[model samples]
Structures are given as structure tokens and as C-alpha cells.
Target: MTVWILVTAALGAALSWLSCRFLVLPLLRRRGVMDRPSERSSHEVPVVRGGGLAVLSGFLPAAVLGMLGYGLASGEYGLRSLVTFDAPGFSVLAMGIAFGFIGLVDDLDSLSASTRLLAQVGVGIIFAAGVMLLLGVGFFAGAVIAVSVVYVVNAVNFMDGLNTLITGWTLVCALWFTLLGALTGSGSIAIAAVALALAAAAFLPFNTNPAQAFLGDVGSYAIGGATVALAWMSWAFGMPVVAVLAPFVVPAYDVLRTLIVRMYLGENIFQAHKSHLYQRMHQAGLSHETVARIHAGAALVCILASVPAVLTQGWAGELVAVSIWLLVLVFYSYGPRFVKEHRAKEHGSSSNNAGGRA
Candidate 1:
């Protein structure tokens, strides 16, 4: 089963990479589907957007193949049995496509924030209700899941400002989920995570500094929806909540802090702005690659720390996870100020040295 999953992932990665480099990129350029430079944008030139179509092209087929493989391996080949074999993973793929469609419309026609939010929430509710029905959870749990889906989808979109920031971070989290699933003997989680990782990996090359194409809202929304779905699936598999949530810690903190600061300063929270911690770090003189690598590194550290904690599974595990979370949060929160202060000190010392020479 593991071997089959690996083969599927490899094929998906190849297909995703080829489609992005050939079909998607050419179509976007031909159609002039470009993201132009703006005050809130990190890039200086227009780049082709909507590259997520390639990701979908790769991921959807792979997911279907994976589900079929799982069903056959389990000797449950009926349509109903296949759908129920891994309800959460199937739901993830379904909701991801729905969200991707919404993003595609927004990319082309530019939907208003209210409309987009409404659409997202509506889809989220359907997803939550489906999961609740399949898993036999309560209405309260379903409501919480719905809210979480909305939050995660938007948070991911918010964090997608920098080159390779969201893409790289997502790849890391997917890899972590894949490992967790393997460790826990959840083939569904492992297969789904592998497909997601491959899709992100295929997209990474184009998304690097001097990006040739952007994921646009389509990729971000699909990735976000898929991420939350996997987290829910992990929870259902009896993984510790902290472990399941570990991958989200960095992005969640950044998004929440940015929103709070914007609201406190009386800025329109819905307006586009380069106020995210990662964006500020770049504006503070760090290169886009530097800032992106930093975020990816932080996410990796948090995920790595979660392993032992998850395995331990108790107050001790919770303590480790919470402590790591707080530590990273403090670092990210104060990072910009620290950079500014250091630069100021350097300038002051240089001025004094010039005076002495004079």
C-alpha cells in the first residue's frame, strides 16, 4: 500500500510539473491572466496567475486513484464503500474543488469580499455538515468545524503574499502530515498528504523568487481547505489535537496578529495591505527568499517538535506543544522590531565612527 502511494505521488508530481510548465503557463500568458504590481504587491512586474489549475489537474486525478487503490486494497470496491472508506479525505478533495471554483471566479471577475466570504462560509457549512453526518458528531462540533474551515481558508489566502511563502510552508506541513499518517497507520491520511505535497512541490519552482506564475486565490483556497480537512481527519484518527494543529501554529499566529493590529489602528481589515509579519520582514530589508525560507524553517521546527509530543500524548505532550507555540509566537511578533533596532544601532555606530574620523 505504501509503495502504491509513493508511485502515485511520483506520477502526480510529474504531471503537475509538466502541466504547469506547459499547459497552464502558456494559457495564462495567452489570456493575459496577470497579477500586476500594486502598492500591496510584493512583486514589481506582472506575472501570470491562476497556475493552480495545474495543481488541480494533478491532485484531483491522483486523489481519485488513491481512493480507488485504498478501496481495492481493503476489499471494499463498491461505490458506497469507497466513498465511506475515507470519508474525511474524500470530503477534503470535494471541498477543495468547490473552493477552487470560487477562487477561479474571483480571479477572473474579482468578487467582492462579502460575496467571497459568503461563498466560502456556505461551502464550509456543507463540508462540516457532511463530515458531521459521516462521523456522527454533534451540531456544536459541526459548527466549530465550519468556522475553522472559513478561518483557515482566509488565513491561507492572507499569507500568500510572498513568493514561495505559502507554497513552501504548505509543502512542509503536508510532509509532516504524511509522516504522522504513516506513524499512526492511517493510509487515507498518508495518501492524501502525499498528493498535496506533490502538488505543492510542482508549484514551488514557478513560485520561487522572480515568480513566473502565481497560485492566485484558487491555489490558496484549495490548499487551505485541504489542510483543514486533513487536520480534521488526523483528529478523527485519534492523533493529539495539538499535533494535528501544530502545522497551523505559525500561519494562524501571523494572520491573527495582523488582523488585531489592523483593527486596533483603525485600518479596514479587509483592505489589501503588506502588513503581514512576513511582508514586514521583507520590507525591513530581507529578500523575499530569505523571508520565505525563514517562515518555512519556523514551520519545520514546530512540526518536528510535535512528533515526540504527539507520541507522548498527555499533559506533558500538551505542555511541549504549547510551549513551542508560545516561543515561536514571541519570536515572530517581535522580529520586525528587533530588526529595526539593530539597523538603528548599526547606523548610529557608523555615524560616530565618521565623526571621529572627521
Candidate 2:
């Protein structure tokens, strides 16, 4: 099983890198599928979009093979296990592909917000229904899951403004999920996590500073779908809820706060804006790489803080997780201001030194 997981991850990484480099990137360039600078764009020049197709291309085959290998090796089922709907991995893969399609369509021809929302809701409900049937949960729980799926999809999309911000963050979260899945003995979860981690890592080089391409809506939506699927699978396997949610604290806070502030200011909630905390950090003179690293570091901290919850699986663990979230929330809320003030103080100190020298 361990060897299978390793092989699956290696295959996924190789496929993702090769596809992105040789297939998707060149195709987008030839087709002129580019994103030009805009008011909300973090980049100054046009870059290739829809690079996420490579991620999906890499992840889909590896994920299917991984699950199939697991089933056959465990002697649990036959080849028909490939289409088994009960397997959480199947659901995860299905969601990623489904959402990726919607995003692809939107990327090629920008869809109306209402149209996109309706489509996402439809997919979310289907995914939630699958989860409900698998878990035998009630309709209300299914609805909650459905809503969470949609929210996460948009949350990830909303944070894709900066280069490697969402991609790197997703990699960090996926790595944590891989560990969690292994510890909990959830083969589906572990396999899915490993595939996701490697795919993201493979794509990271292309998306780093001076990004050669963007994930666009396709990559962000697909990543969001897979992420929520992994989280739900972890919970379905009985991991602590707090532990499951820890990695998401930073993005959730950024999205929710941005939405609330936009509403308060009477701005269009659906309108693109450079208001996210990470975006603000970039606006405040931090480089994209620095801002991305800061958010990734914060995510790592939240994941680590939630480790206690996985160990304890009780009130103590939940408390620790909640505390870490609160601390992170505070940091996100005031972090922009803090950065501005620190920069101001440094500027003032520099001025004083210059005056004394004069």
C-alpha cells in the first residue's frame, strides 16, 4: 500500500509537469488564451491561463489508478471497483472534473455570475447527494455540505489573484491532508491527498514568481472541489472537525471578511477587487512571493496547531484548534495595518538617520 501510494504520487507529479510544459502551456499560447492586466489583476502583463487542465490531466489518471490498485490489492473488489460510486475517491475525482469543466467553459467564454453560480450549485448538490448516500446522512447535512462545496470553490477562486498564492497554499494543505489520511487509515483520503500534493508541487515551478502561466478559473475551481472533497472525506472517516478545518482558516477568513466589507461599503460583492488580505499585503509593497510565502506559512502553522486535535480527538484538541484559528483570524484582520505601520516606522527611522547625517 505504501509503495502504491508512492508510485501514484510520482506518476502524478511527472504527468502534471510534462503536460503543463509540453501540452497545456503551448496550446494556450498558440490559442492566445491569455489574461491581460486589469484593475484587479496582480500581474502587469498577459500570461497564459487554463494551465489547470494539466493538473486535472495529471491527477485524473493517477487517482483512478491509485484507487483501482488499492481495491485490487486489498482484495475488496474486482475491476468493477473502478466505477464504484461508494468510494470517496471516486466522488473526489468526479467533483474535480465536473467543476473543472464548468470553469473551462467560463474561461473560454466568460459566464455570467448568475449562470456560473447556478451551475456550481447544481454540481455541489450532486456531490453532496453522493456524500449523503455514502454516509447515509440526512438532507440537512447534505445541504450544508453542498453549501460548503460552493463556498470553497469561490473562496479558492477569490484568492487566485497572486501568483503561486493559491497553488502553493493548496500544496501545503494537501500535504497535511496526506499525513492526516495516513494516520487515520483512510486509503481513499490518503491516495487523493498524495495525488493532489504531487500535482500541485509539479505545477508550482511554473506558477512561482514571474509566473509563466495562471491556473485561471479552471485550476482554482478544480482545486477547490478536490480540497473540500478531501476535507469531507476526512470527516466522514471520523477525523476531528476542527482538525479538518484548521488549514482553511486563513482563506476562509480572507474571503468572508472581504465579502462582509464589500457589502458594508455597498460595493458589488461579485465584482473583482484587490481587497483580499494577501492582495492588500501585495499592495503594501510586499512582493508576490513574499505574500504567498506568508500565507503558506500561516497555513502550515494552523495545520500544525490542529495536530493536537487529531491526537486528542476531543475537547482539548478542539480548543487548541479553535485558539489557533482565533489567533490567525486576528492576524489576518489587522495584518495589513500592521504591515503599513511597520513600514512607516522604518521609513521614519531612516529619515531621522539621514537628517542626523546631514
Candidate 3:
């Protein structure tokens, strides 16, 4: 069964790569939906954007395949069982695809913030309602979940600026969820985890630093929605909130600090700026890969540290996760300053050396 899952994942990745390389990217380029470099941009050249549609191509089919396989093995109608209320599973899958469409629409026209927020809220409510109806949760719990979904979706969208940052970070989170699923004996969670991991893997090649393509709004929104959905599933399946949220702690901290700082500076929080900690590292002469690696490494740390919590579901686990989260906040606040100063000193040293030689 594991081998089949692995094969399915590999196939999904391959299909995603092919779809992006041959279909989505080419179409976007032909339509001139490229990301041009600007004062607030990270890349130097225009790249075909909206490559995240390829991830959808990979993830959605694999998820359907997983559903079918599970259903047929049990002598049930494959897709029929999935869409029914026996499980809240279909809602997870559908919400991801729905948000992707919303994002694609916005990418095409750059919708107003209020419009996008309303759309996200509506989707969140629908997802919460589905979960509540399927799992028999009360309205209060459902409302909380709905609010969390909105927060995560927007958080992910905000952190999608750098190449391979969100893509790779999301992959790490998905894999952690897969591990958690395996440990907890939750097949649905594991299936979702693998699908997302493989899809992100397929998208990573084109989206790395010096990327050939960007995720655009479509990729970011879809990835965000799917991730939050997966985390919610993990929590619903009995993992502690700390364990479920640990994978995202780094990104959450970074984004929160950025927002607070922006507000403190009297800047419009909605306005675009190259002031993120990761962006600062990029401006300090770190390559895109370096900055992305830094963030990814932080994500990996959070995942590893949170593992015990997922496994034990105890105060110890929660404490460790929270501690790591606090540390990540400190890093997010000061890491960029350290990198910037180091880069400045390095530049000064190089100048002094050149002067001495000349």
C-alpha cells in the first residue's frame, strides 16, 4: 500500500511537471501573464506566472485517485462515497479547488481586497459548515474553524512573495502532516498530505530562486487553502493544536511581526513593500535560494520540534512547540538585521582590500 502511494505521488509529480512545462506556463506566457521585475520585486526578469495551476492538476487527480482506490477496495462506489456526507473529506478537496478559482480570477484582474476577503470568508464558512454537518460539531467550534481557515489562507498568500519560499515551506508542512497521519492511523490525512507534498514538489523546480515561473496568486491561494485544510483535518483527527500549527509557526511569526511593524510605522498594511525579513536578506545580497533555505530550515525545525507534541499530545509537547515559536519570532525580528550588518561589513572589507591592492 505504501509502495502504491509512493508510486502515485511520483506519477502526480511527473504529471504536474509536464502540465506546467508544456501547458500552463506556455498558455500564461502566450497570454502575457508574466511577472515583470519592479522596485518591490525579487526577480530580475519576467517569468511566466500562474504555474500553480499545475500543482492543482497534480493534486486534484491524485486525491481523486486516492478516494477511488479507498472506495473500490471497500466495495463502495468510488467518487460517490467521497462526495457524500459519510466523511467531511470532499469538503477539504473542494475548498482547495474553489479557492484556486477565486485566486485565478483575482490574478487575472487584481480584485479589491474587500472582494477577495469576502470570497475567502464565504469559502471558509462553507468549509466550516461542511465540517460541522459531517462531524456533528457545534456552531461555536465551526465558527472558530472558519475564522482559522481565513487567517491561514491569507497568511499563506502574504508569505508567497519569494521564489520556492511558500512552495518548499508548504512541502515540508505537508510531509510533516503525512508523518503525523501515519503515526495516528489517519489514512485520509496521510492521503491529503502526500497529494500536497507531491504537488508542491512538482511545482518547486520551476519556482526556485532564479525561477522560470512564479506561483502567482493562483498558486499561493490554492496552496494556502489546502494547507490550512490539511492542518484543520489533523486537529480534527485528534492532533493537538500546537502540533497542527507547528509546521506553520515560522511563517506565522514572520508575517505577524511584519504586519505589526508595518502598522507601527503608520504604513498601510495592505500596501506592497520589500520589507519582509526574508526580503531584507535578499536585499543584503543573499541569493533567493539562500533566503528560501533559511525560511525552509526554520520550518523544518518547527516541524521536528513539534513532532513530539503530535505524538504525545501532552503539555511537554505544547511547551516545546510554543518555545520554538517564540524563538522563531525573535529570529524573524532580528535575523535580517544580523544578515544585513554582516553583508555590509563584508562589502566594506572588500572595498578596503581593493583600495590596499590598487
**After superposition, candidate 3 runs with Cα above 4 Å error:** 74-78, 85-89, 355-358
Ranking by TM-score: 2, 3, 1
The alpha-carbon deviation from the true structure for residue 133 of candidate 1, after best TM-score superposition, in angstroms, is: 1.9
Q: In candidate 2, which residue pairs clash? A: none
RMSD of each: 2.2, 1.4, 2.0
Candidate 2 per-residue lDDT over residues 117-221, each given as its tens digit: 999999999989888987899999999999999999999999999988898998898888888778877676788888988898899889987898899899999
After aligning candidate 2 to the native by TM-score, how far in Å is the CA of 44 from where it should be? 0.6
How would you order the candidates by lDDT, starting with the best? 2, 1, 3
* lDDT (10s digit) by residue, model 1, range 1-358: 5885797688668888999988999998998899999888999999988988888877777867885687567763535744564445576687779899999999888999899999999998988887797679999999999999999999999898988888888889888888777777766677778888898888889898889988999989999988888888888777888888888999999999899999999999867799999998888877777888888888887887777778788878788878887898889878778778877899999999999999
Give me candidate 3's TM-score against the actual structure.
Answer: 0.93
| Residue 320 lDDT, candidate 3, scale 0-100 | 88
Q: Where does model 2 exceed 4 Å of error? A: none
**RMSD (Cα, Å) of model 1:** 2.2
Q: Which candidate is the best by TM-score?
A: 2
- lDDT-best of 1 and 2: 2
Query: Global lDDT of each model?
Result: 0.84, 0.87, 0.79
What TM-score, to 2 decimals, does candidate 1 have? 0.93
What's the CA error at residue 201 for candidate 3, in Å? 1.0
